[model samples]
Each structure stands twice: as structure tokens, then as C-alpha cells.
Target: MSTSDWLFLILQFFAFSFLAIGGAMTVASDMHRVIVDDMGLLSNNEFVTAIALGKISPGPNVMFVAVLGYQVGGLFGALVLTLAIILPSTTLAYYVAKWGQFNQHRKWVVAIKAGFTPIVVGLLFSTGWIIVDGFHSMKAWILGTLVMLLVWRTRVHLLILIGLGAILGMLGIV
Candidate 1:
């Protein structure tokens, strides 16, 4: 990639950090739009694969941002994109923590916090939709729905589900 492309990618993620209300996962489709559809850096399969990689890895689900950077530009690209995406959030979180400490008892603050739950849930649903939509098969849809229901309604561990999904994919079951 050229210097301009790197600049654009970094700036886009910096802006996206502010818009990441429920976390970076919520802004995944927008990332997909910019990285895959708009910039044509990665194909749909590549983007979805990156999402899979991110999901299976430990820590924040946003690891795919780094995976994508590495895909596009190698190790340095991974470092740049990870820092670009996280720095804004990290700074905001620090100040928010300080403010939240003082306003923890405020009614409006409680109300705002309560209101965010639903919004975050909705955003996560949309992100799930985007990932599931990539695979155009009934089996994939069924598996996705079943997995989602299991996650939502049961005590099953996420890593187990991920492993099962990987096995199913390998067996061409999804």
C-alpha cells in the first residue's frame, strides 16, 4: 500500500473509534465496507476469514483489525492499525472512568447506562448478521441460529462453540 492508503486507513479507524459505541465489533460492517467493498483490499472471503480469526483468538474481538493490517501490509501494518484503532478508545476510557467515578450515583448516569445495554445488544446482533450473511447456505444459517440461541440461552462455553463450528466447517457441514 502507498503512504496515502495507510494514512486513509489509519484516519478512518481513528474516526471509527468514536463511533464504536458497543465496541469495535459494532462497527464491523463499516470496516468491511471500507476495507473490502470500498478499498478492495481484501475480498469478502478474506474479510470473513479475518473475522473468524479474530473470534477464535483471545482478548478483544477486534483482533481482526490487526489481522487485516497484517494481511495488507505485514507486521508493521498490524502494529499501526492496532494502535490507530485502540488509542482513541483507550484515552476516552481513562477520562470516562474518572468522570464515572464522580457521577456513579447520578440518576441520569444510571439511566444512560441502562439505555446503552439494548443499543449494544442491537449492534451486536447486526454484527452477527453481517458475519452470517457472508455464507449463502441454509446449513450456515441454521448453524448460526442454533449457535446464537445456545450462546444466548445456555451456559455453554464460547470456546466450545467455536471449536464445534470449526469442526463443522472443516466437515463442510456449515
Candidate 2:
């Protein structure tokens, strides 16, 4: 990639960092749009693979940003992205959390927390949709829907769900 493209990705990542309400995953769709659709830095499959790699082999799912950076710009890219994703959000969250602890019972604070619930839910849904959006088959749609339902409605273990998915994929069921 050109220096300009690297600069663009870094700047976009920094922007996403602040809006990562629930987590970095919440901003995955935006990342997909900019990185894959708008900038053409990576293909959709590569982007999805970064997410998968982050989730499956991770200290945190947020590490997916590192994968995206690495794909685009190697080790330096990874380090820069790691910082971009963490620094602003971490600093913001730290201050916000401290403020929240002090004002935990205030009406505005309570309202703000309540207000974010639906937003976080919507963001999470969008992120999931972005991941599922890649698969076009009816079977894939069904499986994706089933997983979404399981996640949204039930208390089932995520690992079990992941394992089940892996097994089904191995058997060519989904």
C-alpha cells in the first residue's frame, strides 16, 4: 500500500476507536466498509479472516484490528493499529469509568447508561450481520440465524456453539 493509504487506515482506525461502545467488534462493520469496500485495502474474505483469527487465537477479540493492520502494512502496521485502537479508547474509558463510579446514581448518568443499551445492541447486530453478510447460501443464512438466535435469546455457552459450528462445517452441514 502507498503511504497515503497507510495514513488513511490509521486515521480511520483511530476514529473507530472512540465509537467502539461495547468493544472493537461493535465497529467491525465500519472497518469492513472502509477497509474493504471504500479503500479496497483488503478483500472481504481477508477482513473476515482477520476477525476469525482474532477471535479464535486471542487474548481479546479486539486483536482482529492487528490482523487487518498486519495484512496491510506488516509489523509496523500491527503496532500502529494496536496503539490506535487502544490509546484513545483506553484513555476515554478510564476517565469515563472514573466519572461513572463517582456519579453512578445520578439521573443523567443512569439515563446515559440506559440509552447506550439499545445502541450497543444495534451495533452488535450490525457487526454480526456484517460477518453473516458474506455467506449467500440459504443453509448459511439458516445457520447464521440460528447462531444469532442462540446468542440473543439463550444462555448457552459460546464455546459449545463455536464447537458445534466447527463440527457442522467439518461435516459440510453449514
Candidate 3:
């Protein structure tokens, strides 16, 4: 990549980091827009695959950002994007957490927390919608609904669902 491309990548990720109010997952749709639609750095299948890999991985779901960076510009790109996405959020979270803790009893703080709850939930739902929409199949829709219902009603482990989904994918079930 050229110097300009690297700069744009870092700047984009840094901006995205701040917009990740609920979590990195919240900004996933936007990432798809930029990475796949706007920049054409990755195709839809590749984007979905990256997200699946990130979800199946043990650590933070935000690992998809690294996957995107790698797809865009290899190892160094992964490092740059990961740091860019994490650093701002981490720093802001640290200070805000301390402040929230200290002012836990304040009415405004409580109101702020309550106000953000629905927004966060909505953002998360949008993320799910974006991922599921990529499949473009009725079977995928039905399976997703079933999995969601199971997650909501049962004590089944998520990893088991992921494993089942993987098997279904391999068998061309979804």
C-alpha cells in the first residue's frame, strides 16, 4: 500500500474506534460499508467469512477488524488497524469507567446509563441483521431465527451453536 492508503486506513479505524460506543460489534455494519462497499477491499463473502472467524475465535469479537486489515494489507495492516481501533476506545473507556465508578450515585450518570442501553441494543441488532442479510437465503433466515430462539430460551452453549452452524455450512445446509 502507498503512504496515503496507510494513512487513510489508520484514520478511518481511529474514527471508527470512537463510534464503537457499545463495542466493536456495534460498528460492524459501518465497517462492512467502508471495507466492502466503499473501498472494495473485500467482497461480501470475504467480509462475512472474516466476521465468522472473529466470532468463532476465543477472544474479543473485534478480531474481525484485524482480519479486515490483513485482507487489506497483510500483517502490518492488521497491526495498524488493530491498534487504531483499540487505542482510542481503550483510553476513553478507562477514563470513563473511572469517572462512572466515582459518580455511580449521581442521577445524571444513572440517566446516561439508562439512555444508552437501548441504543446499544439497537446497534447490536443491526450488526446481527447485517451479518444475516449477507446470506440472502430463506434457510439462513430460518436457521438464524432458530438459533436466536435457542440462545434466548435455552441454556445451550454458544460454541455448540457455532459448531453446528459450521457443520451445516460444510454440508451446504445454509
Candidate 4:
């Protein structure tokens, strides 16, 4: 790759890592902003579509890093952004683990967890909302509600629901 390509790759990698709060998936919203809004490399609709695809894949939602990288700068960009998306949170989780070991029984630790629980739940809810924004229709709502019920009531694998959704979409039912 050229020097500029390498530079952009490195920058994307670290930027993703820095945004790793409430887990790597939360970084999707920021990445959507970066790719669609700041970089003007993708439209808002494209951003949402890519995020849905990324979430449906077998890995973390941060897979959008690799997808965006591939679109922007080819294979090398994908590799760099994958690393970027992983490295920061891995480091933070490691440190957090270490800290937890040190402060295992601290009341402040319990308080901190209690404080962050709602924020984490809210982030997850927002992630779901952003992912489905492009699928606004009665059919989409019906399928989404069924999927939510499946997720809530049983041990059905998420991949199965995603696959069924894809099949339904192909049939123009979702």
C-alpha cells in the first residue's frame, strides 16, 4: 500500500479502539459517523446497511471496521482496522480485569457497576435501533417482533433467526 493508505489505516484502527465503550459494538455508531458523515465515503443509508451486515456476521459488530477498510483501502485497510477495532478494548478489558482482581470487594466497584448497567442497556437498545432504521415497514416490524419474541422466550440461536430473516427478506415477506 501507499504511505497515505497506511496512515489512514493506522488512524482508523486507533480511532476504533478509542471508541470501545460498552463493548466494541457501540463503536458502530461512531464508525457510521466517520464513514458516512466525516469521510463522506458512504451515505447514511449505506452506513446503516453495513452495520446490519456486520452484526449478522459471526464476529463482533466492529466487523464494520474491516468492511469499511476494504471498501476504502483494500485488504491492508481491512487488516489494520480489524486490529484497531480489537486492540483498544482488549487492552482495557485486561486492565479492568487486573483492577477488579485488586479491588474485588470494594463498595465503589459495586456502585460503579450499578451506575453503568443502565447505560450499557441503553447503548444496546440504541444499537438495535440504528441497525434496523433502514428496515422501516409493517413487514419489518412484524418480523422484528417475532424475532424479539423468539429471542426472549427460548434458547433459539440468533444465527437461526438471522438466517430466517434473510430467507423471509428474500421472499419479500420481511
What global local distance difference test value does model 4 have?
Answer: 0.74
How many residue pairs clash (N, CA or C atoms closer than 3 angstroms) in each of the candidate models, in the order given?
0, 0, 0, 0
Q: How close is candidate 4 to the true structure, as a TM-score?
A: 0.72
Better of 2 and 4 by lDDT: 2
Which lDDT tens digits does candidate 4 get at residues 1-174?
568756764677577687665566656767776667766776777667666777778876677777777776679767877787788778888999899879978999878888889998997778666656657687776777778788889999987887897898789876
RMSD, one per candidate, in order: 4.0, 4.6, 4.0, 3.7
lDDT of 2 by residue, 61-100 (tens): 9999889889988999889988998999999889999999
Q: Give stretches of model 1 more than 4 Å off.
A: 1-13, 21-59, 68-74
Let me know the TM-score candidate 3 reaches against the reference structure.
Answer: 0.69
Shift in Å, residue 169, candidate 4: 1.1
- Best candidate, lDDT: 1
lDDT of each: 0.90, 0.89, 0.89, 0.74
Worst lDDT 10-window in candidate 2 = 127-136
Q: Write the per-residue lDDT of candidate 3 for residues 79-131, one digit (tens) a residue.
A: 98999999998999999999999999899999999999999899778888887
Candidate 1 vs 2: which has more lDDT: 1
Angstrom error at residue 159, model 4: 3.8
Of candidate 4, the 10-residue stretch with the lowest lDDT total is: 1-10
